[model samples]
Target: MVFWILISFVALAMAALLGLILLRAHSMAEPPAAYDLRVYRQQLSDVDKDLLRGVINDSDAQRVRTEVSRRILAADAQLQKQSSGSPQPKGMSRLTVVLAAALLIGGTLALYSLLGAPGYGDMGLASRIEASDNYARTRPKQAEAESKVPPQPNPNLEPGYADLVAQLRQTAGERPDDAQGQALLAQHEANLGNFIAAYQAKQNYIRIMSGDLEPQDYGELAELMIMAAGGYVSPEAEELLDDTLRLDPRNGPARYYYGLLQGQLDRPDIAFRVWVDTLRQGPKGAPWINGIEAQIEDMAFRAGIEYSPISPPGAAGAQAPALAGPNAEDLEAAQEMTAEDRQEMIRGMVARLSDRLATEGGSAPEWAQLIGALGVLGEQDRAKAIYAEAKTRFADDTEALAQLESAASMAGLEP
Candidate 1:
């Protein structure tokens, strides 16, 4: 009863307001603005004063006075008509206003009755959420299908890479004692982003090379493990990364991957700092710089910092020194040229380097450079041949053997 009483009062109040508007509209039928008569008479007086002062010419004053006189006459006529009490018609007819008000109220309520939950009670926030939850529970299959789909394998892997992987697996299986073969398989798998096989091959290689391990070896294993876990650096990988940094604090790949792990763990602050420092220390021509630079921009955005990365410390003159021993200008020029021209230039340079190594006998670093250049150019077969030749040439020198072997291993050359 109280609810019905309140609704009745609201309806009555709205009707009363509408009636008042119609009444006022009726009163404004004549729109009594006869004040315009007084304004026009004042303008006529001003024009006469201007004529007496000779401020405006007599002809101009006469025209202004005539216009003001004409407005005065129109206002006087309107005022006289308003005061005549002849029952002037209103601008809006009374019946039309009544019908319009009725239709507005009725149409609004009718639309609400048609579209709204007229019979249902109000649903608060909690009730709405609970209703959604009930809907989800009612369709278990749909919810399951929509909310959880099995992850798929990487679609971007090269088809030929899988064949290489099969051959690599066969070799590793047939020669379990061939750790070097396993190491090469690991690198090739990693390059192809087949991190699961890469991790397995790296595990085998690490076990065999336990006595001859370096920080780089541990870092490689950590990276493979991280990739196998789909970018999540697991606790096992973290331990490997720690071991890598313990042996060598400035390992670029290890540190970069460590930063990635930090980002994955929701520590953008730590990731940003690590990557910024690593970028500063690394050469601009480093292969990983491009990836790091892209990642660092995202990190900076999430960390809410406007970061402008400076070129690595030693890239002052032309370009950062290439790891493959190309001069700064050559590498910079490669970036500026067309792809075909760049390839031709690179082939020429590689040929020259190869010719020099074959005839004059350059340093171990030079041989490593040629092999690395071959790797970058996707000539892994040629790189493997170069690695074999460099091994024989550096057989008497342990340091030279280590450097050349490291380069060859990076290029995916088997022992």
Candidate 2:
């Protein structure tokens, strides 16, 4: 009787345990709770009352009642089973103990293989997440800490001429064929008054462009070359102006500059021609045109030529003070020469200038000056040819080469 009573008690405990497990599993399998079970029960009661009062149809009442009853019975069954202790471990037989030990060892090994070290994977993930959150919350402070180190300028720089020369030399070395590099080197040399070096660099840059230089580059190059000339006229520079005009005849800047170059070369006739051309092509009241007009008037006056000048009325509204006619000195300078003689002189000059530039090895800026001098001397053909050859050779150097071509063309030479 005692053994039977013990068996019965054990069976009851197993049933209760089984019921508790089923109840817990069922609860876990449901969707996560959005509201209390008590609220659900209250809703059910309200619906039941509505049906009883005929506020809802019989069919709806039936469906609602059936669902509620099913859930309640399932809950009751789960609770009863949990209380009965339905689950119990097998007896402590030798075979049972061996199997249990084997399971325990296998489970530990499986967990280690599948999940890595117990606190180094998922556990580590949680730690990382916490750290990331902390970092996000203090991100501004972290950024401020990082920004405490101020930016630093180049260490090897001494400022002024030394730095400029060093940088230019380095840039030239690194980018041998780069026009901008050449320009920079030329700039440094010019600043140092190394005109010969500057001119050489400028010409080398122009020579590299094998006919790929653009119009804008041509205009800028002409401007720079004019500045580089330092007041000497050269056949090469005349050829550059010719090429510049050919590329973009309508470019007012090019036209105006060409006029100035012509003036320097002692070709007032051509200079005045270009200045007039600018006036016709550019806006009537444009500052560039007005400036060129002023220049033309001044030149005309110096040549003993008459032109409309802005002058104040004299006493009794008499015309403005009239200047004397061209003096012997002015006429001698402006004397007309045969085209043949002019061409011969230009040819000789170009030959000499080319030799100096090539054998003597001038700088880029000096070369620019030499080119301008050629234009002023009326060696337009030689200048144009040089610029054209440069364009053909330095196809990649658009700006410098284009300037050479434009300046040459503006001087009325074919490139």
Candidate 3:
């Protein structure tokens, strides 16, 4: 109310100033002929003075007087004609002033009403941060967010595949201790868009494999939980993300979701930094890279960064990075070798691949293959080291990290 009063006062004052200027100009203005008449009368007075002082002869003074009198008459006649023809419209002038003032005041108020938040008070930076923190602290829980999401439609699926999924779910429910069955159930459930069921299956899998839980397991659970809540990163999902990142600090999915959580908490500054770093360490087709590319500009704006949009790597008809791996001809030749000889050849190939990777960086799949080959050779320490390095190398590529994690598990390392 006070703000409105102040704005109204200022607008009214400006309109009043304009009205005074207009009125003063109208009142002080004189006709051109009136100025001419005044000059002519002054000249006539000078001629009379000249005659009295005997500065001019009687005839000369009389001629000057006549000429001045004729000019005065002509000027007076023009002034009277002008006055009668176009009399100052005092009422119209007042009406114009009134309209102008009304427009000024009314237009100002109307524009403000349209564009300004009428009742919202100004917030300082600290106050805004406090409010955002409060809001984040009180945001909806996992169950509440899940409840608010509308039911998703069943995906179109082949009858054979659907029946298999249903049978898998029933079997997994019956055999609660079957870790492999639960993992399969979770995978299929998530594929069917049943994320709530998927996460529940994943929870069972994690419990059954508690002794062998991996960072990918926690990341998967968090992703399912977020999907269950229609992409809301609830507290439960955040906890899972924390676990994933604690186990593997460079986990791509965990970091991406953490960035998303920051954004939801109204901390775009942190979110922007996290996403920018993640996007920079990209294998072009990573899921998080696309999500970050789509939203990073808006986040940058919110965080007050002057950012220009960037194209994703391998975009615009650019060739994808070539992945180094064994060719089909090598596989065919290995097949013809005896078991002992094949084993020898495999060790030689693995040694060569490892040397090449050490000299020049390779794709995530090639790294995973090397880890798995080391595991096959019973080199546990080397496999573990390779797995760790692979995780760090492809830290921002979620799919690549998943593959690396799978290779790590197969390598018989503790999760």
Query: Residue 89 CA error for candidate 3 (Å)?
Result: 3.6
lDDT of 3 by residue, 250-274 (tens): 7767888999999898889999988
Off by over 4 Å in 1: 1-66, 75-181, 191-193, 307-405, 408-415
Q: Which ten contiguous residues of candidate 3 have the minimum total lDDT?
A: 315-324
| Model 3: how far residue 302 lies from native, Å | 3.8
The number of the candidate with the highest lDDT is 3
Strongest candidate by TM-score = 3
Alpha-carbon lDDT of model 2: 0.54
Across 18-104, the per-residue lDDT of candidate 1 in tens digits comes to 877777766655434355776787888889898889899989988998888888788888887676433335645566667766876
Q: What are the RMSD figures for all models against the true structure?
A: 13.4, 29.4, 10.6
Please give the lDDT score at residue 68 for candidate 1.
Answer: 81
Q: Candidates sorted by TM-score, descending order?
A: 3, 1, 2
Give the residue spans of candidate 2 off by over 4 A. Answer: 1-162, 187-195, 261-267, 280-294, 302-305, 309-415
Between prediction 2 and prediction 3, which has the larger lDDT? 3
Q: How does model 1 score by TM-score?
A: 0.47
